[model samples]
Target chain A: MSTTQPHKKTSGAYRHGDLKKALLGAGLALARQGGPNAVLLREVTRQVGVVPNAAYRHYANQHDLLQAVRSAAMSALANAIESELAKLPSINDPADFARANLRAVGMGYLKFAQDEPGLFLTAFSVPDDLQGTAVPEKAGNSGLNPYQLLSVALDRLVDTGVLPNERRMGAEYLAWSAVHGLSMLFIDGPLRQLSPAQRQIVSQRLLDMVEKGLV
Target chain B: MSTTQPHKKTSGAYRHGDLKKALLGAGLALARQGGPNAVLLREVTRQVGVVPNAAYRHYANQHDLLQAVRSAAMSALANAIESELAKLPSINDPADFARANLRAVGMGYLKFAQDEPGLFLTAFSVPDDLQGTAVPEKAGNSGLNPYQLLSVALDRLVDTGVLPNERRMGAEYLAWSAVHGLSMLFIDGPLRQLSPAQRQIVSQRLLDMVEKGLV
Candidate 1:
């Protein structure tokens, strides 16, 4: 078994105690700028002002570093969604709440994709085991988490008789699929034909269909 | 204006033949095995048993080579969908046709992603102008393309008074979004929790909703 060491630094200019955090932070910045491929171990060490060997004490290799970066990106995305959801009014109506919450999550997700395309791509590109395991606790707590937040909202919708409990998974998948697909298409696919105004109109129409489908 | 040379063989190995097509073919194979990053100029040249500079005669750069790979991937995808649709008996039945066609397209896409994640990623990663300019004659034929095939089927549904003409774009977008989203989720997202059976069930339910909405 390989023994892992903590990234405790004891030097002059590089006295940042947590070299792992520093490397991850710098890696995320690089990922945001250029993409996953840009998050090189050498460049990250250079950014953190550490010897290349120091990085190996924290991350096993570039893949490990990239995994940390990917986790950070997911955590960041979850935080953005939570922040957006918090800004909305707490509606008593379940359907209204669901609508607002879904919109907030979609907006937050789209914002992350647009603002940090490289990091966003990295977040999705990592292997499933890594993503499932390394998703931060903060991400779990945030209203930004699609599965947790959407599932809660969906349960509420079922309780309120807006959607039948039998079709909860169906409705949830449909809602997630529509918004998620549109987000990807807008950001990366062939459907970038819509102008800003047209996009807004189309987005609203999409939301309206989701609402109608649930009802 | 930069003077661009038509396909010139820098090495004697390729003569004056279809070096562009050969490079694209080799690039696709590499992409299938590794992913987009695997399709290196040097590697592709090595595969073709030609000098690295000889590839530049066919593709200006790595980006151009990737674009060709992407175009080939899309064309392959379109062909797969067309072949699947041709096998279905209910050409006039919009709901049935959409269900089968969408599944076929999604399966084809997912299979591509699973079998050749690199090429699949590259297929989506190439810039729009490259993709737009390289629109295959199959895509233009409308009958052979999945999107066009769906559109034609939807048109028939509208003519038969099953679906409203006014909501065609909305319906189209919704259908496309759901299936595309599900495909992405299955391929790269955190939906690996789904068993193959569960995935099929979910897909069928989504198609059911689309049929209900359209009708």
Candidate 2:
């Protein structure tokens, strides 16, 4: 993260170590209401009932805070996928296993967007500058980021011989674009007017297309 | 568009009729530089060398101006697709014509995003209100708006029996999602690192998937 001039505060360490966690929770709330634009360092500190000067310790600037929020978003997305996968029936065939897992990835993604449109958007709102902070490529408490989870699911498709080896190089991107498009269209585009039941049908149709296209 | 209290200026008609066109051109430039956020009413007037209060004669408010810009964006996108289609060979078979037209639409959409990322985004950035603006539902000088263009291409697919009737209802949304997602990823996501030639390959791969899935 890019550094700014240090905040002039002798009591910078006065807050308990929980201050970082508090700031993130408040930031998420702001993002929930106003999208990425609402995630300001000063605003989060104010919401956390801390001196504005103390924000620098946890985040160098707004960009640093945004990256952390994005990381949290990825974890939340991964957890959503896991919850969906856990509810599925046990797989008896290798091909069905591959298809179910792949379909679950998309279903989980679309369902998460339906349930938490705010967090879903925050997950991909890339800032103009990341200040060299690596994206949360590492798994958080949820055990996987979105990219890792998707990669694993696609690998299963190859392992089951459902996806030909020659077509695997960029399959993740193709599948991801379709699912992401459906979610965004539902959340912010013309599909926002659709009833929940109708949105669900569209989601299934999109998933069907993704599966057909991949294999 | 949302209504604002009318500007209290007595000299509303002092400027020539060219002011409206001048403001839209300037607004498009701002959108080109900074997506939706930069297309401010005051800023557009400022760039156009007009009094801030004078903007109301042309636009009720920012939302009103945004709707106009979006209309222009739709026209621009349609024109981009037409330019691409013009370069293609004439096909005699109805099925081949349908496929080529659909492919051209996606290619045009992606190319427009690559060429004018800001305007491309501003085009789809729906305003909070769209009360009375003439959306590009009718054919413009460019021949179509983005949605109308897509509808025409999809209609051709069914007319030629290239796509089955049962799959026709929501197929446009599915196809749109794939292409839109690909363009968004190419513009702002991890795919931004791809070189132009590399992007070309990915674009074709996505179109192949889209065509296969739709048929």
Candidate 3:
């Protein structure tokens, strides 16, 4: 797509304002291949057929470009979770719905990590806290980032009386820690070689642990 | 120490094969500051006052040197856990002892990550499977590596009838994932800036989740 539309025209002038979009697209492609560290300004600019100085207008430094890629990666993660949330069947029990929502959030997270390990690493590459940024850029179609989605699921548990009121506080972090840890094990740790079936079994067990332990 | 005794004599000959020890010393020092990626052969050789070829006699390449550093880092982690185990008070109840042991293991793992983030990162940098190498070089004084230490604690839980026998098979991986994920969060994720007291509280809660969930 970038090949069809260069950042600059034959007149040596800018091509309106599609430069930022092209830069982000290149950045996301780099992140998909080599993670956060690979989202270099020079490389992205080169890919977009622009000079480093032209790229600098959009990103002051490599960190700036990386942050943009990080946000996109996070949004992709939020979208993955949303995909899982969208698959829920109609249920009457609030507690059951809450449990299912929470499970879907976790399964989506693990699936994303396995299918797109590079992007998964890039999403959390930034040192942003667990209170994820809810800005529109970082949100999925549901208007919530991954952390917010997890928080909402945990809140559902409390609202449905599946989790105690006192335990509701910081419940998201506990569950996130479990699921995040499992994802790390699968992507970068010893569990990297786990077969798809094995990953599914372990993932369910881990979610069960978080579900059972939190309540 | 290498400054006092060079790896080679003035005659340009090997000095009693202490080159490997000196190289390792330099590698560990580098790893302490820069994690696994910092343990470069050229850099270590420079610090050891040796040429690249001389260093090659000990480490075939950067990966070889990194693997050695990884082993030392793993050993240090095991030692830290052993220190925690050493402080346990005498207990009459087997179940209580088993629970305390498991708690100590998790606490020690967390403490090491916070105290020595670099080495903690290095320890698991190799991506070796969770069945950690039981070689003497990677083990602590107790003749067990970190993974083995964790396994022993889980085994005690099973033997004491605290954890179900059926659940004891893959318990180590589950426990490892939770604790390891927390450590990563503290070291590289959003929890990096957490105060010590807050870290302690969250850490205890995480350990609680693992203990309650696993059982």
Candidate 4:
């Protein structure tokens, strides 16, 4: 394994070998502070202490930088879900595991939205072509992308006979739609009327419905 | 029926009486052209050929003006849904009527999202305090808000004995979550890959699940 230090030095500012990472770091910071609109190439380069034109070496334009930042945001969200899943006690019962997994993921997603609204918005709002290129490889220890995590939970349900295989896609869509819809509502809709504790109750109720439907 | 058009005219560059309405119109035009961010008070005033300060008399700031524009957008959406509901052939079956009503509402919402993406976004996004003041009152119309329309359909399910009244809120949330999630995906997510025809099928399938769950 290559040991990576916490703060490795790169070459001169203009020709820094890690300029790509620097650009993404600056872009994510800007997104967190303002929003997608704030991720301008000139300003990002300025923050990185490099000339505007030098940024072109790493990212073709502002859109390119925004895409990179968005990919990072998605990866960050996936990682949070993974961490939450790891904390749950192992269950021999697949249906119980599915419920726990869904709750963990939903809570992680909502927490991400609350903690990093700009990054969360950017992760969802970036255009498709950019997303296709920038999303991290979905293999190795990461085990799953957000979609795949949900898919696996559904697959486990099928394997354990909690849900019929014929109901796979419909079940997946239903589960996703509920949690995703609630997340959007919490982040951007009238559902903000609920206090944090109330929101938690609502989230769990939604997850319960999904598990009940699957069972 | 009282047929009354309130036409209170103002003097000079300050169109006092209908300045708010005029500003909303101008703002909507701007939003249609270039999403929500394009809606600037100065640009709206310029488009109306009024002095910049004249706009402040009607709108305290851009936030207030945007909220007005958002409310107008939602009112237009509600009207569209009402018209669609009116056009449906009368059926004796309440469940059938519920299905038809839900479909019409979904189609209207999707149409609004496609036709006026910016305004649709603003319509949902304005802060609650700002929205409460701006949402048009439908006096003597059976107290119909958009959410209530869905609630009425759910009530039909209860009346038909398809769903228990105790589960009304859960069922309502489930249905809303599915449709609202599908709408957001169509408007802003990867579902854009589907043709319009394919999208319609996906939407109908979603609605089928909601109706099925009531059984």
Which scores greater on lDDT, model 2 or model 4?
2
lDDT of 4 at A49: 81
Give me the runs in candidate 3 sitting further than 4 Å from their true place: A1-17, A40-42, A51-54, A126-137, B1-17, B40-42, B51-54, B126-137
* C-alpha lDDT values of all predictions: 0.67, 0.79, 0.80, 0.68
| Among all candidates shown, the one with the greatest TM-score | 2
How accurate locally is residue A208 in candidate 4, as Cα lDDT from 0 to 100?
66
Model 1 regions more than 4 Å off: A1-14, A126-144, B1-17, B91-119, B126-147
DockQ for every model, please. 0.30, 0.33, 0.30, 0.22
Of the two candidates 2 and 3, the one with more favorable lDDT, higher being better, is: 3
lDDT of 2 by residue, A1-215 (tens): 35654444555645455788888899988876666767888899888878887878888887878778877876888888878877889999988998899888889999998788777777766455321333457463457876677778889899989999888856777788888888877777667888999999988888898888887
Candidate 3 chain A lDDT trough over 10 residues, lowest sum: A127-136
Could you give candidate 2's per-residue lDDT for residues B1-215 as a string of tens digits?
A: 36554444555635355888989999988887777767889899998878887879878888888777877876788888888878779999989999999999899999999998877777766343321333345344566777677788899999999998789756787788888888878776767888999999999998898888887
Which candidate order results from sorting by DockQ in descending order?
Answer: 2, 1, 3, 4
Candidate 1 C-alpha lDDT tens digits along B35-67: 666778999988877778898887888878877
Q: Predictions ranked by TM-score, top down?
A: 2, 3, 1, 4
User: By DockQ, is 1 or 4 better?
Assistant: 1
Each model's TM-score, in the order given?
A: 0.81, 0.86, 0.85, 0.77
RMSD of 3: 4.9
- Candidate 3 structure quality by residue, lDDT tens digits, A1-215: 75646444677756645788899999999888777657778899899887887877878777777788888888899999999889999889999999999999999999998888788887765322223322324787788988789889988999999999887755666788778888877876667677999999989888887888887
lDDT by residue for model 1 (A45-116), tens: 999888888998898988888888887877777776677677889788777776677777666666666556
lDDT of 4 by residue, B110-178 (tens): 666666666565565534232143333432134465666666767777787767887777777767776
DockQ of 2: 0.33
Model 2 residue B2 CA deviation (Å) reads: 40
Q: Interface RMSD of the predictions, in order shown?
A: 4.6, 4.6, 6.4, 5.3
